[model samples]
Target: MAGVESAVPGASAGPELAVDGASNPDIDLLYDINGLTKSTPDWLDRAIGFVGEYGLLIALVVLVLWCWASVRRRPEPEVSVAGLVWAPLAAGIAVLINIPIRGFVERPRPFVDHSGLELLVDGKSDFSFVSDHATLAMALGVGLFVANRKFGLIGIALALVEGFCRVFMGVHYPTDVVGGFALGTATTLLLAPLAMALLTPVVTAVSRSRAGFLVRARRVPLPHPAVDLPEPRVADDATDTGSGRNDLAA
Candidate 1:
């Protein structure tokens, strides 16, 4: 009887909970693009992946060197000092903002979501929204540009390249990189003037100290005196005397 009752097909089951797993459409598009990049030569793939993962460190070092060169008595010392002071400052601001957002957003990585995909570099399963690379790179680029056009242009290029690489390597979404760049650029520009003002005294004092010998003028305001010094005392009387002598000789 118990078997017969069990066989009566457990009274019709209630409707099951339908879990809506809809994902952002951007993910598919970005994933498609990343896949396309893999068709390239293996050498290229490896090279690009390396750049995407590690090239920015080189870029950051280059930026620091640029600032250092400028600060160390190079042309446009004021601007150089600005670059030196602001690049790290902006990067720090970017990192600060990124950390909180990363935690709050908590997005999944592509590799984790889609297994079987080849990875050229080490990847993380943590959130990928708003890439830290893009944020910091953009901040550094903008800060450098503010200080010097040439350095700024280079920085911007480097940031753009790094963003593309982050997307190409499949570690980050296109939106993640784009959002990071936008966020970083905005934060740095907005915070730059205030940060610089607040840090000036401290930086200046440090630069002036013996330890800052590497910095030109120790951050001191130097004379950029106008090139137009009153035309060297015209020696009007000497010329007049020469004219009279010529007349007498004639």
Candidate 2:
């Protein structure tokens, strides 16, 4: 339960906690990555801890809202809105799905089994397999991507960083983060088409209602270019004068 402040250096850190005392890549990777925390300054470690635990997730939520605000201007507001709506829903569903898996796997926190790890945050009493943070982040990322490609890519990148943060924080093994990414991606991608099919019509209906402002804003009219008018022509006064003279001479 201790944090990076209590990290043990070198072999004195203790023995491998793998089952039957056998070493595996998962734990090895966990230690290798978590080990980096010890090399970093405590302030830096704390910063990473805050970012991994909360900052990135908050950014993702803002990204979703940002995406929603942007999609309203798109030609297909209904489609975009439907996708944006699904992003959070997917994250929620993914986290809910992880609950049963966590209970079934009952994997303990990395700090519980391993020693000398630089745990960034403390009081992690729940199971560690398929981290909820990673799951929620990736689900939102993938779901956002389904709605808007540009923003979605940013979301996915953040989610990947989030996965690394979990391992770096010493709360989860690399595989655990991978499992979360897999769960989130699969759930969002697999059910996306169906979700879109159902949600689009509802969005379209909203687009037509007084609440349409939520879907799309009024279009701004473009200004027209200026043009010069031609001048009117006038008959010569000489012709009229000559005609009068000829009549007087006659």
Candidate 3:
């Protein structure tokens, strides 16, 4: 009966064994990768940590500030105001979408649950489906780029660096960073137009108020000095005296 059961066309130990063995290479590779990562010098880890922490933050801040400044300098108040509104709105959307999605996916962070990675800094994150840092960096970069091309380029560069840093730091898998990039890019593109539309009315109102203030300021007569300054008196004799002296010398 055991031989008959084993001899069934569909029943086989071969497939089972193959399936079990399938994980071996992956496990071995994982171990090898982790071993290599573990051998990384301390300096590399420190550099990765620095870039992950300060580099991303500085890039984001600078991009936002640059956008705000550029918009503020515009002749129309709406453009500047709209830029301000959209930049922050885009960032907010990235956060709102990325956080919950990451939590729900619950993919283990690289070093925390996976054996093949080393983390530069330990994160409390429970999932590695998407990287929040990458999402935020990319979203901010795209938003800034939309606001101003030059600054946006800088933002994009920073975003790429940040995404790479996640992998280098060993807190996130490459797939996690890729997912984050996609989500962040999509979030920025989706929210940008909406943010602009939503901010239009507010920007218009602000522009109107600003125009009114300018009008009022122009209308406000400058207080004249208590007494008008007399015109400067020319010394009529000076030129004549100089000419006479020149003539005499001649």
* Top candidate (TM-score): 2
TM-score of decoy 1: 0.70
Please list the C-alpha lDDT of all candidates, in the order they appear.
0.70, 0.86, 0.65
lDDT per residue for candidate 1 within 70-129, as digits (tens), equals 657763354457556777778887888888787776666555554334556763656777
**Between which residue pairs do clashes occur in model 2?**
none
Q: How many clashes (backbone N, Cα, C below 3 Å) per candidate?
A: 1, 0, 2
List the lowest-lDDT window of 10 residues for candidate 1.
1-10
| Position 43, candidate 1: lDDT | 84
What is candidate 2's lDDT per residue for 173-242, written digit by digit as tens? 8988999999999999998999999999999999999999999977888887776777787667998899
RMSD of each: 12.7, 5.0, 11.8
CA deviation > 4 Å runs, candidate 3: 1-41, 210-250
Q: How well is each residue in 102-202 modelled by candidate 3, as lDDT tens digits?
A: 65666655444343355567544456667778887888888777767777788888889887777766666666777878888898888677777777777
Clashing pairs in 1: 145-152
| Candidate 3: count of backbone clashes, pairs at least 3 residues apart or interchain | 2
